[model samples]
Target: MPLVRSAHERGITTLTLDSPANRNALSAGLVGELTDALTRCGEDDSVRAVVLTHTGNTFSAGADLRNPPPPEALVALLRRIVTLDRPVVARITGHVRAGGLGLLGACDIAAASRDASFAFSEVRIGVAPAVISLTVLPRTDPRAVARYYLTGERFDAYEAARIGLLTVCGADVDAALAPVLDGLRRSSAQGLAETKRLLTAKVLEAFDRDATDLSALSARLFSSAQAREGMTAFLERRDPAWVL
Candidate 1:
């Protein structure tokens, strides 16, 4: 079965993260599938926009601890979303953590339900949100990024929106997305693509400038002794030795 599922409505293509069993973790396979799906959307002139969503209570639980994609793959996936010709929007009604927040940041717009929560979970796992910073840091408030990235504490949708991590949040996420989708539907494909290019130029520049160093940083941290212990403790459901 595919980890990512694709569906189309009118001029919009909706790509859903479907690995609920693992909270839609970004395994290599899932990343590849989603990349391919977006490539298809980019090539199809009929596709005016794309909606990225999920199938479980958690939109994504960051990297798949047991089968995480290489940091480069994650970086490529994020860049794909940023540069895809059609506008990419995130429709989230669940929790997002770590690398998942990268997806939210790459999108041209993101809407979430009021109950949705977010966190930068890498710190707890003895890693930095290095690769994701390409999309995240450029879009979110620097002070807010400092707090969440260092503390790994969860924040609600309202806070996410306030800090520029989300475009909107409401009691009903789909209803909140209605006008946004309607606007996309009414837009000329060429106009949407050109405008999106303008909006995402800075993000793409960041990708070009920092992706290599960040991916290397990610690989180094994930292989370190501290990271091993942290990931082990996470998997074993116990506090790591350094935890007080």
Candidate 2:
């Protein structure tokens, strides 16, 4: 089944991650599907804003290393969300880790369930969170990011909101996000697009002049010895035995 699912109505579209068994992992095919969906949404004038959510307990558990995606493919999908003309909001519930956190950052607004937790756990497996670095690094507080990235520790949704990772928090995340959607509905699509463009331009400028180097770095991380070991261990249901 395609990982990306959708329900469109009244000029607002909700795109859902649907691979519940795998916690909606970012497989290569899934990345392609997401990219395609986002492109279609952008081209559709009726879609004024997008609300991203997921099926089951996890919003997303991040990438499935057992079936890894191409670095460039995943990166492009995230870039699309970041640069999309319409407003994007993440409706986060349950656990969101690693690449999942990247999706939250890419969106213009995020609302999390009161019980949800956010984490950056790539380091626990011996590799850096390269694919998510550009998005998460800027949006999250430096100290909070440092603690999580360095230790692979988890933080609750309220902390996520406190650090600017989420715009609202409530037991009913959908209810919390409804006002944001209403605000989007009241605004002009062109105005929203221009605002998003201006914000993203600032984030884009943070990278060095040779920003392609970051892409290269992500590719390298995917192919690294540590990543290989970590992915193998995960599939085997064992602790990764990597020498630091």
Candidate 3:
């Protein structure tokens, strides 16, 4: 079955990430599926906007440690979201973590349920959120990033929005997204495209300039002995060697 399911209505293309077994983690296959789905939307002139959502209670748990996506693939997928002609809105229905936060940051706008939580979980596992920083650091508040990136503590949806990780939070994410989609449906395609370009030019420049360096940093950390032991301990449900 496809990892991503795509549907269209009223000029809106909604791409639902469907890999719930691992909380819709960004595995190589899932990223590829997402890229393909977005490419299709790009080609279809009728697609006025896109909504990225997920099927599970967790929007994503970030990169699947057991079967992670290729660094290039993950970065490319994020770039695709930012560069797509139509505005990309993320409907975050649940908790988000690590690289999953990257997905949220990449979208032009994101709305989450009031109960949704978020965190940068990489540091706790002995690796930093290097690759994801390309998208996330640009959107989130610098101070919040300093704390969460280092501590890996979870925060609520309201804080996520306050920190600029989400555009809005509500009892129902769909309710938050309704007005956003309504506004998009009213925009001329050309206007939307140009506006997005204007909004994303800096982010696109960062991707071009920093993605390679960041991906390399992520790869190095993930392969380090500390990260190996940390990931192993996490998978084994035990404290890592460094745990006090």
State the C-alpha lDDT per candidate.
0.93, 0.83, 0.92
- What number of backbone clashes does candidate 3 have, counting pairs of residues 3 or more apart or in separate chains? 0
Lowest summed-lDDT stretch of 10 residues in model 2? Answer: 202-211
Model 2 C-alpha lDDT per residue in residues 23-85, reported as the tens digit of each score: 888887778888899999999989999989899999888887777687777678878898789
**Steric overlap count per candidate:** 0, 0, 0
- Candidate 1 local lDDT, 28-138, one digit each (tens): 999999999999999998899999999999999999999999999999899999999899999998999999999999999999999999999888979899999999998
- lDDT of each residue in 1-244, candidate 3, tens digit only: 9999999999999999999998999898898999999999999999999999999899999888889987889899999999999999999878899999998989999999999999898988999998888888888889988999999999999999999998999998887788889999999999999999999999999999999999888889988999999889989999899988
lDDT score at residue 15, model 1, on the 0-100 scale: 98
> Which residue pairs show collisions in model 1?
none
Ranking by TM-score: 1, 3, 2
Clash pairs for candidate 3: none
